[model samples]
Target: MILGLHHAQITIPKGAEEQGKEFYCKILGLLEIEKPDSLKGRGGFWLEVGDRQVHVGTEDDFDRLKTKAHIAYQVDNISYWRKVLEQNNIKILDGVPIPNFERFEFRDPFGNRVEMIQEI
Candidate 1:
């Protein structure tokens, strides 16, 4: 009854593609893939990591916290990711780098909170 995860979708605020590219590709190190021809005009970007893929789409209105959803990426180096995010002028959440798991949280231009974690 269980199947593999084909992909996941995240709704981004309108006009946030550039920032999304910076955060997801440059900062998070996810690979960008071409969107399917059928969804071309929908306005979004697709990213691949291992066997999973995430699709970021444009939404006229988005409320990050109100959506009660967030995505977490497992990283090998939290500090490096943190520095990358800060160097890009992205603000990170406070109180990160917990004992067993070093982590950092940041919001995309659309206000979606993304967290990077590494196990100790």
Candidate 2:
């Protein structure tokens, strides 16, 4: 039988690892975990989200803003996140309403779409 998601991968422009860490680690408070030694030579980092991992890989010459693909983080308090993002000058986009859920979206510095959601 198939298992649950082990991790999800996202891309940022090559050589932007430090900037990515600033946002994903410092801003979002996601725990940074050491990548396997075998992958250390690669220009990217890993994050621990609960039991799962988010693999941030490096890529070049791609338009990230044009894509709707994103990761939706289920948070406990949606309003708190909205305020935090707004205070940081991140533009909050109204996400489509879904029954039993409140959510909003925003773009990271590299133009990655990120969503915050909480169940009603």
Candidate 3:
């Protein structure tokens, strides 16, 4: 039986590497790890988020649109993340709160939905 999550991924259109890095690394502060040589030809990125991995892969003909699917990264200080998004010009959606976690959503540069969450 399955035990736990290994990694998660989102897609961006081709040629958005720099922009992906800017959003995932520069703003979100995730560490960029080198891709394996076997996957070097595939354009994308890998980020270290705590013990989890966030993969940003490229699609040849992807469209920029919002979707119901999203990746939520559990973080400390929801207020701090809000300011970071706002200061960087990323709009934060007023997300519905759950019993144990507070959350908000936003779109990445390529328009894939992402959510930031904090546990109370």
Candidate 4:
């Protein structure tokens, strides 16, 4: 058998799953997909964007202050995303320019780091 990258699961501290759903699903406009029936009791949510899927999991004892990894999304216009983030009160890090893309970073409500890149 062979395998390729299929999905990524992020663990959210304590009771932050609902916030994750609100941001990733509603704010980001990603479509939520129901988890398989056999895995119903597990706590999490899934979102589908094109062929990639992201899953956010809930953990009771996780510490919110700890440093965490993040996911990045490519956007058509960084300015538009900046406005959206500002409207939602999400803080955006000053962006740096790459060779062909401009990169901006931010953290989710639960402290999950995220980035947005737009072609320059």
Per-prediction TM-score: 0.83, 0.98, 0.93, 0.85
Indicate whether candidate 1 or candidate 3 has the larger lDDT: 3
Clashing pairs in 3: none
**Leading candidate by TM-score:** 2
The candidate 3 region of ten consecutive residues with least summed lDDT is 60-69
Q: What is the lDDT of residue 118 in candidate 1?
A: 87
What ranking of all candidate models by lDDT puts the best one first?
2, 3, 1, 4
| Candidate 4 local lDDT, 2-118, one digit each (tens) | 576688777776566788888888787889998998775787878886688888888866655476577888888889889888899998896566788888888888777788888
Which segments of candidate 1 are over 4 A away from where they belong? 94-99
lDDT for each candidate structure: 0.81, 0.94, 0.87, 0.80
Count the clashes in each prediction: 0, 0, 0, 0
Q: Over the full model, what C-alpha lDDT does candidate 2 score relative to the true structure?
A: 0.94
Cα RMSD for candidate 4? Answer: 2.1
Best by lDDT: 2
In candidate 2, what are the lDDT values of residues 48-93, reduced to their tens digit?
9989999999999989999999998989999999988898899999
Query: Would you give me the overall lDDT of model 4?
Result: 0.80
Q: What would the per-residue lDDT of candidate 1 be over residues 1-120, giving only the tens digit for each residue?
A: 768778888987777788889868876778999998999788989999788999998887556766547788888888888888888888988544578987777777677878788899
